[model samples]
Target: MEALNKSFFLFLASRPSLDRFAKRWGSKFGADKIVGGETFEHAVPLIQNLNSQGLRVTVDHLGEFVASEAEARERTLECLQSIRMISAHDLNSQLSLKVTSLGLDINPELVWENMIQIMDEAVKHDVFVTIDMEDSSRTQATLDLYKALKKKYNNIGTVIQSYLYRSDQDLDDLNEVKPNLRLVKGAYKESAKVAFPDKSDVDHNLKLLIKKHLLNGNYTAIASHDDAIIQYTKELVREHGIAKDQFEFQMLYGMRSERQLELLAEGYTVRVYMPYGNDWYGYFMRRLAERPANIAFALNGLFKK
Candidate 1:
């Protein structure tokens, strides 16, 4: 039953027709709770509020899978604008974006050019940029781009999904860069040949990756909502005598609000992954697919206002 729910939402997430319909409604279905806003400007005050509460933030301009160079360029400009805004507002925030939105599929050269523009602005503003991981098929290409960018910029980071069979070795490969990584138990649906087919395996692997990455002495962002995972991290860091500065906790905005605050109160750095923009349908569906508990708020959103 749980698997069926996941697969159903995943299928809904991929439908262009549904995506179009969602845009017409404009974040009406509880998506406004998870999504920051339809634009970065609309999200500015929200970021300020989170910062005031001592919670750091990373804002993603919600979008992906661009099919045109023009669209990709537009995405790049949005990212550039976001960096400048983060700096101008003096907000405690980082920038996160999907490479596909910047022409990863349209053309590599185009994507690289777009990335260089965004990276230049990010560096100038002293804002960190993290390249979000997509599905299994694009993992290597994403990592390759990240490695190239890492060579040129020190304020860059990328996600590593523990569900993938290749992630363990990918960490070793990335260790050379001393990467600042946000470790996640991936969201996209993937074949068992490439991803662990069991939730237990995925959870166990996440713990292992967290341990390996932290002990590797790289900056680690342990992104999870599970209490078990949180407990494991606390015990592991304490046992290893790891410094608090070496790692932090990350959670999607509006999902684990109380836990995020508790962690912050406990002196742990907690970053809220707040995504803004009109292209929110796909992201919203994925959040529902990730945890059925999210559907409650989503349903609540429907009758709201």
Candidate 2:
């Protein structure tokens, strides 16, 4: 299975055009079809529907690596606008932002400032913000921005990828200042030197972090569709006697609906990440690479088309 997974990922990486194809197909399927996009306008209705289904939404503006500080400022303002709109609806939706979109690639300080501006708007609207973790190269900058924001806004949170070797220490460091986090097994393709080359190692790290966070009184969001991880998280929650609402079980919008609903039915808080916009191909490609099943399905769809 692992070999198949790696082989499929390699095939995915080689086909850069597949990203464009996925995006076009995704948009044609409408907001219900894919998650993560260029803007949040197309996502609002889908988000409303998910909220109606008793699932919270995390809105993410789809773009990475700003060309300049001005662009980052504009993107930050756009995110704030989305947050304001969600707040107006009084819906169960929050914003997820990428630091690079906020000028981290140009200047770390500019990224921090952009993030602070967005958080300021969030504070005004009483909305929460989650900082999405990027590739390993930007992890330090993302962390710095999160640390700075957390010192000011208690409602601000960030993500930690279990794939990185430094993640354990990163978690410990972040926990010391603020513990609210979204934990994922990671989706970015990275070097074996800096990340766990084996799936077992990443999965093992994910389980360990869940155990550590749940027992340490932190409200960590376990964002995974793996059955064992989900079951383990539930078991840990039960053993630790953590309240159902203390944490949320998060999943991507189109993936593992059965497990998501099952957890929700069991009284666990479930948040569905409903991303939308024009730039969906990049997001879909990442999703396809993350799960071999998704890759197979996508490839079949392509051939059928």
Query: Each candidate's TM vs. the true structure?
Result: 0.98, 0.91
Per residue, candidate 1 scores C-alpha lDDT tens digits across 195-271 of: 99888899999999999999999999999998999999999999999999999999999888999999999999999
Best by lDDT: 1
- Candidate 1: which stretches are off by over 4 Å? none
What digit string (tens of lDDT, one per residue) describes model 2 on residues 159-278? 989999999899888888856989899887788899998889999999998888777788889998888898888888888788886788899887777777788788889998876555
Q: What is the Å distance of residue 227 in model 2 from its true position?
A: 0.6
